[model samples]
Target: MNIQKLAFVILLFISFTICSFPSTSYACKCVEPKSPTKELRESTAVFSGKVIDQLEKGRTQFVLFEVKETWKGLNESQAIVETVNSSSSCGYEFEDGKEYIVYTNETDGHLEVSLCSRTHLLSAASEDLDKLGKGEEPSEQVTLDLSDEDEPPVWMMLSLLVVGFGLAVFYGIKRVKKKVNK
Candidate 1:
């Protein structure tokens, strides 16, 4: 009887473990960005640009950039790059009017960027800048003020709250059941 009870408890534990934690289907996994030389060699394009605007289309966000300088692959004065909207999906959040040193891959003739890329804010890309040396400047400079950005969307906050509540309920029931069993 004791052995049977032990086995039943072990099965219950396993069931709870499996049911309480679900795999995150939307998470992104990426390898670390390589050194500047390796990054330049591997990437299709590398440039500095100021984000002019962002357009959301389905699961992706498109950032329109006014190209300032190019190190490889492109010579256009304007470019559009696509990234997923969710940060968990390795998406890059480009602030409007902010300058960035973007590293990109050419996929189906589209420029793609992610958090895993060596792309970063102009203020934070000193290493890439040092390696790139001098580059041809754009003919015109553009800037915009976007200080009135909105806070986190309501759906995101509500989703987090729901998850938290679910976890709390799960643990609370487990604790009450343990006390009852004792």
Candidate 2:
């Protein structure tokens, strides 16, 4: 009847609204990479490091690296690099407590890296190691000092806010429809 038709129309509208949200994931497009030596020459900082921590803010993931050795551009034993979250966006994913040979280029005063760069996990970077030879040792050992936290992460807070808002809207619509029927 009319009630069934109205329900179908509401469902279709809700489906369309959900489908219109912007997608964060994307396909990565990159040109053929240059030689290792060329990549090194073009990079502003080349080093091996362990990822101590990572924080995501907006579209960028901030990685805290404890530098072990330096081939170029880094003077501090600790550095922060910015990368995207998805490889499809050319972002390089660095796992916590894992060592990697990172090649970074300076972009607007921050170190940036992508999968298209010469960066790789230490165990898989033998070819790049052979090309780099022995790099300079870090002047001082760096350590992470993370404090214990009891609060939930930012994403969790945002998700809760969204769910609360959606429930409020759903109930409001249902109340309005009930009032109209009565």
The most accurate candidate by lDDT is 2
Q: Could you tell me every candidate's TM-score relative to the true structure? A: 0.62, 0.65
lDDT, candidate 1, at 111? 91
Over 19-113, each residue of candidate 2 has an lDDT whose tens digit, in order, gives 98866557888899777789899999999999998987667888999898889998678888989988879999999999999999999999999
Q: What 10-residue stretch in candidate 1 is worst by lDDT?
A: 140-149
List the global CA lDDT of all models: 0.82, 0.84
lDDT of 1 by residue, 1-182 (tens): 24456557657876887799896558878886699878889899899988998987657788989898988887778888889898898999999999999999988988999889899999998999999887776554545332334777768997897698568656766776687689
Which ranges in model 2 have alpha carbons more than 4 Å from their true place?
1-25, 140-182
TM-score of model number 2: 0.65
Question: For each predicted model, how many residue pairs clash, with residues at least 3 apart or on different chains?
Answer: 0, 0
Choose the strongest candidate by TM-score: 2
